[model samples]
Target: MFSEDPGARIEEVFRRIQEERMAGLPFINPALSVAAVGFARHGADWRGVLLTPWGIQLLLLPAVADWPVPPLLTRAFRQYPAGTFAFLPNHEKELGDYLACPLISDMHPFADQQTALATARACLIALDIPPVRSEAQPAAPASDGRRRFLGLDG
Candidate 1:
């Protein structure tokens, strides 16, 4: 529904959740607040990071109108530049259908909001990097390179 600015809408929705449901929870970090980071159009979806007191997640919200909502509690896989990741389907009354790939499930490790925000941004950067592929190398003979490299051949 928020085709123009889905990130702002997401922040608002989670802010409400923070106030109504997450307050005083033991696992939530008090220093962190709800935020949407690096949101931009990605094909037919808006991709970004959602930072909250409880966790940090990579969010994918539909950009098109009338996008179908997947069944709740089901996992969906989406491909990013980094790699394919599993996202959980969820719907918010205000935010509508979206997918979330949790990057950090515990916020307690972060000392402050800035540190958490930095981590969220770093995650976005990491997601943009393509996964590395290594070529296989032939194994060296045990008595040859292995012993020589260790200077034990003599």
Candidate 2:
């Protein structure tokens, strides 16, 4: 299934691996990140912003079980639209949260075009900083619904 969307393809590969290792097939949950994001410590941040009705369903459904994301991005997906979002992990981890960073083109450690494209397509709802030309843009409708969170808890 590896096609032009190498990143997406790779994500699928890793997901299958995870599913196999879990002793059973993967459930229908579009878990948007790595095994760590699913972990109790990171799941909340990863599931932060993009918790829409459809987004929620995609994430929790077995048909769309797609995650395997980068750790730094765990914060970015906090607000992206779940259905339209994608979190791409660099094949190389030494690069770390660097992102080859779309906004900072020259700042890349390794090219890894596929991974770069994947990073570009991640679930970023918004950012205090933007990616490179690439061109600056934002999703049409917010992943969030009626109201936004002020981060205050009762």
Candidate 3:
């Protein structure tokens, strides 16, 4: 109901929760945590979140600089294992470059350990190797004609 009438939807949700609270109901926390992070030698934090229907119960706090202790975001960041992390603007090249850096712990957004490992492996592979000669290797074509005279390859 957040489309045509956002106020009504918010009111309804609040009213339902209020009723549930009055009845001493338990809220099933509905949300999923997806993370996009940037990292440096020193620190990092989550850039965005992945949410599920139940997980939306999370009322996120502002960044730590502005917010008080016991912040929701603090808890979320803490939930992640201590290691590489950051909140970056969405850009694959930049993220890939960051991933390639040697100091990063390199675990990324995948829920599966293997998948995260794969990203690290891929990044490392990219950095360690030269680009493949996709356009065919440069050859001494008997002359530096730049372009073959009507393609002498025939």
Cand. 1 TM to true fold: 0.83
Candidate 2, residues 1-154, lDDT tens digits: the string is 1112223332454445445553333332333332211211123222212111112111211112243345653523333222223333343332122112122222133234444334433323333223222245543344332122211111
Q: Which stretches of candidate 2 lie over 4 Å from their true place?
A: 1-3, 25-74, 77-154
Give Cα-based local distance difference scores for all models.
Answer: 0.78, 0.28, 0.26
Tell me the tens digit of each residue's lDDT in model 3 across 1-154.
0112122333344444444542332332222122222211122321222221122111121222333233222322222222222222221221211111112222233455345434434432332243333467654333322112112233
Candidate of highest TM-score = 1
Q: Name every residue pair that clashes in candidate 3.
A: 30-54, 30-55, 30-56, 31-54, 31-55, 32-52, 34-50, 37-86, 38-86
Question: In candidate 3, residue 6 scores what lDDT?
Answer: 24
lDDT of 1: 0.78
Kindly report which residue pairs in candidate 1 clash with one another.
none
Question: After superposition, which runs of candidate 1 have C-alpha atoms over 4 Å from their true positions?
Answer: 137-154
Those runs of model 3 whose alpha carbons end farther than 4 Å from true positions after fitting are 1-111, 135-154
